[model samples]
Target: MKTHIVFGESGGSSLRLALKDHQTNENIVVVVDDLMWGPIGNILLETVQEERIKWWEQVLNEEDKSDSIAYLRNTYKRLSDWTIALTGNESFLFWVGDSPTEYTGLMFLLANIPKSIPVSIIMVFPAYYKRYGRFKPLSAGEIIPEKSSILLKMQNPFLHGLEKDT
Candidate 1:
């Protein structure tokens, strides 16, 4: 009955928090499993409900780094469909990589998602990270203010919620 998916480089934080909140309110149940990134994965596992955990175990079995990412994409594709079927109405609030230009799979799926399904897509503004040689998270709006650029071209599906700093 709940539809929420979060992806990205630290982009999953908002989605994870929303899931936790929903669980607390007894409105929904969450299964938490994440692609290994860093400390965030550990924190998420500890915080998410045990019953909702659906981890991509194949990633662990793969020796190649690219294979792991591929497994993640395939896993989500399968899970997304299952989640939609299990719940009658389908709604997805996914926060993927701050920039779709960098994350090809996320961009492809978002664009190619069936329009007939009445799916709601929200792409969170990217927050710069230190690992990318930046000391802090930077907004795509700030980095590339030009509206002509592809980065700023996509309209946020859930603009109202984003206005409040979700």
Candidate 2:
């Protein structure tokens, strides 16, 4: 059986929807992280430790500190485990938007995965118009629930390489 891993922010909702509605035979693993909006100077935990501490101090109260820290640690582990599981044999796809946050997430994944593991990126823009009509580019959440069928039907989908724009 072929396994296709899809990674994105917001818990890979869009990718999950696309796979569920279309590619039922393939095993799908979704790695969702909000790394794009956070302080990610480096993919290494050590490099981002200071930033993480600062963020925790600023955003979390004393009562919530322990719980929040634990949550972050757990999330980091999950992200690391899933990312490391992307071998060259399994297909990989990254769904990202044209935003700094999304781009940062994509960069992080690109840096972590081995060069031999070919990665395909689907870039979502904020403003796009269809041939039949004009519509604003939808966010991942909006697109998944509203237009997943369209995504499933897409042929020759425009995919970019990880090396091109990073």
Candidate 3:
């Protein structure tokens, strides 16, 4: 099955639904951190990760944001372990939107994902018109459920002929 790595829970939920609609039984992994605005020093290191979490906590507290940043700990570990355990039979598709957080997540995965596994990316861009209000998607998660199956049609070049029917 294809392991889809997407940013945040909303994206994960939406993608999950889309995959179901297309009769695809792919797995969805969500990385909840908004890595766009925080410390990047030794980000993969355990200590540095703790420090980064602290920084996020401080920022949230200062801004009176009620959401807790503690989820980062589990999410980081889960993502790390998942990627490291990937086998050659599995494939991946990273959904990227025109946003810093999405780019950051994409870069992180690209840097660590093993070369043995087939990898692909889905780039989401905004389409807009000034003359009249037209339909546009800000992110992959924002895609309407009924139309989301279109994203699944994207081909993974690395697995064009290697795909197995499971």
Q: What are the per-model C-alpha RMSD values against the true structure?
A: 12.6, 4.5, 5.8
Ranking by lDDT: 3, 2, 1
Residue-wise C-alpha lDDT for candidate 2, range 54-140, written one tens digit per residue: 676687788888776776666566655655565657545555555665666677766755665555554444322342235544344
The Cα local distance difference test for each model comes to 0.36, 0.53, 0.68
Per-residue lDDT over 105-157 for candidate 1, one digit per residue giving the tens place of the 0 to 100 score: 33433444443333334343332342133433222223322221232124345
The numbered model that scores best in TM-score is 3
Could you tell me which residue pairs clash in candidate 1? 31-52, 31-53, 128-137, 128-138
Expressed as tens digits, the lDDT of each residue in 1-166 for candidate 3 is 6888788788888888888887887888987877777777545456767877888877775444344554677876876676556666888887777788899877766655555667777765532112114755556677655555665565345543234211
C-alpha displacement of 121 in model 2, angstroms? 1.5
Segments in model 2 whose C-alpha atoms lie over 4 Å from true places: 1-11, 23-58, 62-68, 126-128, 131-133, 152-166
